[model samples]
Target: MTSKSGRRVLVADDDEAVRRVVHRHLEDAGYRVESVPSGVEALARLRGAERPDALVTDLQMPGLDGLALLMEAKRLDPALPAIVITAHGSVETAVDAMRKGAYDYVEKPFHKDVLLLTIERALLHRMVLEENLRLTEALAREFSLGNLVGGCAAMQEVFRLAGRAAPTEAPILLLGESGTGKELLARALHYNSARAGKPFVTVNVAAIPESLVESELFGVVKGAFTGAVASRTGLFQQADGGTLFLDEIGEMRIDLQAKLLRTLESGDFRPVGSEREEHADVRIIAATNRDLGTAVEDGAFRRDLYHRIAVVVLRIPPLRDRIEDLPLLLRHFLGKLGAAGLEISSDAMKHLADWHWPGNVRELENELRRAILLRGSTGSIQPGDLSPEIQAGRPPRGRGDGRLDLRAIEIPDEGLNLSDLEREVISKALQKTGGNQTRAAALVGITRQTLIYRMEKHGLK
Candidate 1:
């Protein structure tokens, strides 16, 4: 076989003749080979300078056996694939080797071709594992608290609240629009908390039909109902000792809400068909864009459950309310798209900032991604590159009368978001009144305390 140079394989066996033959075969296969007399020597080499791509160790060694060596090798590099060379024809030993995470195994009298193939497979497995690690690390860094891009006061406060809530096991209620990144924040909370290494299961209450909501959350037994052929584990059990994020939780039926409340209060739930109660140690984090407070008052949601899941509430400001972060978010998306060097024209930036992002950050990201794909190799983005809705959102050619003309305001076909419109009007009122809170409150026909709360909610000065 032609040598595969630069690929290193470490061989550990007490037999000198075996080592010599194996070394010769690997070297001829274009691999750099290192032979060690025992598992201890192999470990020292692995820990010392260079690391091998794969290990070939004998099942029986003097000081450390092949199984022990494999465990240590995994501790050093979990991605490293190892092959066990077992001279013994014992099936138990082979099973033990496999149990200890052996990539592949060969008998002592194995053919050279078989050994070479096993080594090649091990190397390929290692490469895949390394690539997965790189991607996982990249994603972790991308969503890390420090890496989340936003400098506006509202965003800063959100970050602060998330940081404080991360280390605790309290249920967090995330309030925001559909595309406002509630799930991302839920993940951040999970990965930052003590449950970081545990499962982070999600259930979109709105997506599931009302009939299946309970079964999906609480699992089912064999013959639980029609089409129930086998016992099934529910999301609650799957998220045991971790986090369970219920998205659009307000859409859950009131009857299901009571069952969910029971789970939250006691961590106990019964499957749809089973009379026995099971326990799951899961931390709940519920999110919704609807006014859950109103839902509770309207008898659409259970009042007790509302208060139970909302141990720590975080209201994510809509994109329009925190428009100051638009530039940063645009740049963030550009960087994520591998277009960090691309610049947006001032007019384009203004257009992006001025438009009410009903879909919030998700929409912004999609727009940037679409823009990048559509405008290939373009040096920069201009106003015309934006969507028609964004372009038409700009205030029309003014009367030039210097006087404020509401008639010139151009509303898009999607119509104005009443919440956004109200926020902007209040903001403009505050701006026009030179930061006089009382006068601004009076002009908006709201109580001073109500105005103060709105200002704080919008993160306005």
Candidate 2:
């Protein structure tokens, strides 16, 4: 739908003079323009399919007040960018309008470029958001429901919920502890969705800077900022026909939370510096390690945004909780690591089966790779070749002093789940050493290859 040209512009102001001024200014700036006197007229025009890329409306109008009109326009298409005109220092109203879904606000009597700049940024922002979702859905892995990895009953339930929820168009939120593979669940949802072939964009909301997160997600035109030397697209636009994964979304700043809520509702946004609206067909998949409910109660996160993004909540359990599949996981990792063709010593194997791994699958992989690396040119791994920490009967992890890394487990005298216990040990040991399988193996007095083998055996990852 993109052509080598400018974007659509909608002007809604009762002041004929102001409308004419804005219309001419935007047209001269290389945009197609349509002007209406009031919000009601703007809505009628939009409903008629004369959708504009952006709308510039005055706060006060004869009918369908600007705020109400803006809300209605968004209801028509959240992607339709808009800017509100307000009196100077009336930022409180502008902020309220933003909370109500306006793209941005411009004080009355501002320079033409100021208004133009706001619209440009808004349009570009929408473009990037769509693009981000486009990439995410298009590039998502083919993760079937059965391929969710764990066989534990808890995981099985998770898989079931994920599969059941995949086909729907509603937003999905995945909640879990750190390192619990929330992103994987999100990818699974996208890949299994109807828009699987489109883009699938991921934005670690916590990772992006507060100052730049908007432009980075929405898109930015040339000179949108001090360092923006050229035009750039945001994640939203890139994910136009796909899914957008907002990871660690709970970490986003409070100010940006309102903007996100509007976009989630409207599905459109502008770039960093443009007076145009960018459209996209996007789905959202948000994941977080923090408890959003708590954050909302604490006033750290917006309530509206939470409800918008959490239509379908999937909880990812920690590795320790599902230890029954340790063996399966260990074998999977071992095969992937190419650690086959090596004989395992019963002594080493037992040691691995008994140790605690804290790093989860990632940690297990580290330990296994380290062990394999120790195999040298001969590719023959031996327990004696293990790292000194492991050889000294310490966890593969580095020690600063007295960190309670792995707590040795006491196999119950009456009864205990052997498979589960072994996986827990493997997970803890790995976590202690930060997933250094080789060192972990050595500390447990086994070869790194043996650790991998054990991780595989236990499905510990």
Candidate 3:
């Protein structure tokens, strides 16, 4: 009765007869089965390189009893489902096992069909858990910090603090401007921690409706309110054993903030319309552009919660402060654009760096994207290709008098003739240099022969 799925099962029992019976039945039912004489051997087998698909063990095994083994096994592999085997009339202990997170339990002297059925259910659960983990990992890829770019002093400090805090279970508070990549830092912390393979959930407090914020954070039970037909788990439960990012925490209403504070303090929360409280094992990482200290003074944010979440605060510097990183950031974005043929001129780069980036890195990326498209076949971005505000912010171009002035040469709407302007500039340069082509060329930062050729072309006798 070998199982075609090639699923593996580990059975541990002190009684040789019981172990042989379970092993034979499971193997005949088309599963690869292994048996251990004691809970100690069962643990060793579970801790081995090849983990079984499911575990079944006796509750009263000598040394490292089934309950302790189940806990240790789950600690090693959270997704591994298990069934506890107990003597008949020991239903109390079986209930305790359930409280401790067992998938199911089978009474001793049970029929072979019953044991097989329990094992099947446990295996199905294990499959579901594995699929959930896979999907969570896929979603986490969106916020991965593997590609974060910056090497400035301010950003280096940020990375240092983030690296120091990632391995611990403490809640982290990220403070920064709107576009300073706070959420990105939070994801870095999660991926670098022990729970990297687990779910990483994000919730924007400002985005969700105030009325539904509680249910959204802690979940909702059926009949909780209007349109509540089915029970739903909240973000906290979904992010259990992983990280939960609370973006824009300062925007949460005061009342709802209190409930959040309780969860942060005790790791226990009650779903809407449910009397029972559930425990969540989630690491919280909250971020906000607003100053929570100001909000606390205004009675908008909870002080206790602030202290709880800000145990290790990391501040992300605004792009303006990290202007030295512009070149690196620019290269990073240009490479991402995949425009192998395009480059940026030095004047265009100066224009980019001079402007105060009120919108931060996000605006810079958007501007670069627009420039890449608008460049067309030009092959390089110039000062004129940038927005009018950016061009207006450029350093003043010098006048013929050798004085810097704000007044720039303006062309009429119909556009001035380029030949007329070039001829006028050459005649004036020759007059200023006493008709000497060398001094005139030096004045205009060009070679003497180029100046003579321009003079002849303009018919400047």
Candidate 4:
């Protein structure tokens, strides 16, 4: 089985038999378990270069107790899940553990199955909660730039930029093609930045009309224009201390660009009819699917404002450039959809991964969702289940086959061939590593189920 922790666990229990039992059980469960006698040694392991995903410790250890370890663990990483095992009548210590964020505790004589299940569930729950917190923290990461989606060296650079840009107050300029996720990156930048708590205001410059743009942006004073009966504020004022994203800046009217520049420069604006100036503290981020340099040369954009907003410029690659990410994205999306009870077939997935998605990720997701519904079963989704449009966009042959295809990646020909591969790989890797999917995936440079699918594929009993 694959380790839910994906890392080692530190077990601090003085009982020799109990220690051996835990070490063997967790090791069988695919965790690299390190058992130690005292809380002091466990704390030493944690504070040193070696870190555990979770800690299972017994209360009332000599000198340094489990309660002290819990405090230190919380200080190190608050989300680190801990399971406290205690002797009976230690109700006070158990209650204290919960109050200080020890996830939950089990009695000293806890069953082996109970301990393993508790550890697995606690770790998985912690992972989900951390992911949510990260999502909330990363609202400003400009996901468009990082959309390439691979752990490849080239892809790491893109992710690095996204991480750095997520927390800044500076305006981020995303330059990319129409299908390259410029807007997604813009949203990431907002969610991960200082203004993440505030609203992210977006305006498509190309979508608005030149005549009504001024009134739309600055709002109208009472009797400011033909339809102006009352006063109102605009999007810029509404986005104070937050982010205002202007997409397709090249298409903005030059006159309107001047007013926008004024607001960016001095944070001051006046209603269409009002002579008084109102101040707005808004951070401006801009995106364009076109060449802004060419637009600037042609006098379609002001050079000064371009420098102000382009303080952080990120160029996103097209889907064709980072096609290696297709498989990982495939696994992530398929796993997610499967959890939601939609089983996508390998052939259908092959068609998807091999296709030239001109519409990029958005198109791939739509097709997969449609395939799920069309199949109308929790069983596998096959090539026949896909829309004709997806089948038509297939990439060149051998695109989906990697170097380790035989062991980690499955090929869907027809009939029951796909599951055959899955079963074969899972069975062999389990046998070879004694049922450890995590190490097998590492050996193959792919995921655990990828190996499992091959085990089932080849029927390697």
Per-model lDDT: 0.83, 0.76, 0.83, 0.74
Stronger candidate by lDDT (2 vs 3): 3
As for TM-score, the candidate ahead, 1 or 4, is 1
The residue-by-residue lDDT of candidate 1 on 1-461, one tens digit each, is 32367988999999999999999999998899999999999999889778988899998899988889999999998888899988756657977888879987898788999999999888887787777667656655665778777799988999999999988989999998768889999988887788765678999886786688888999999898888899999999999998999998876766787888889999999998999999999999999877777556546677899889999999998888888888889888998899899999888888888787767899899988877777645688887787777788843342121235679999999898977777897899889889876567546544344565567667777
lDDT by residue for model 3 (313-348), tens? 998888888999998888988888886557899999
Worst 10 residues of 4 by lDDT: 397-406
Model 2 C-alpha lDDT per residue in residues 1-461, reported as the tens digit of each score: 23315688888899898889888888887789889898888889889855777788888888688889888988988877789988787889888999988989988787888977887898887787678766654455446565667888888888898889999999999987656778878878888889787777899875666789899788999987899999998899999888999988876767778877877788778888888978767899998766677667656678888898888898877665666666666666667787766544555444444444455566556766777777555445555555455455556445422234456746577888877876787888899889876457545543343466678777876
Q: Which run of 10 residues does model 3 get worst, by summed lDDT?
A: 395-404
Over 116-194, each residue of candidate 4 has an lDDT whose tens digit, in order, gives: 8888888887878777767655643434335435665655775688779768777778876556667766777777676
The ten-residue window of minimal lDDT in model 2 covers 396-405
Between candidates 3 and 4, name the one with more favorable lDDT.
3
Flag the better candidate by TM-score, 2 or 4: 2
Q: What order do you get sorting by lDDT, best first?
A: 1, 3, 2, 4
RMSD, candidate 3, Å: 17.8
Residue 166: error of model 3 in Å?
A: 3.0
TM-score of 4: 0.52
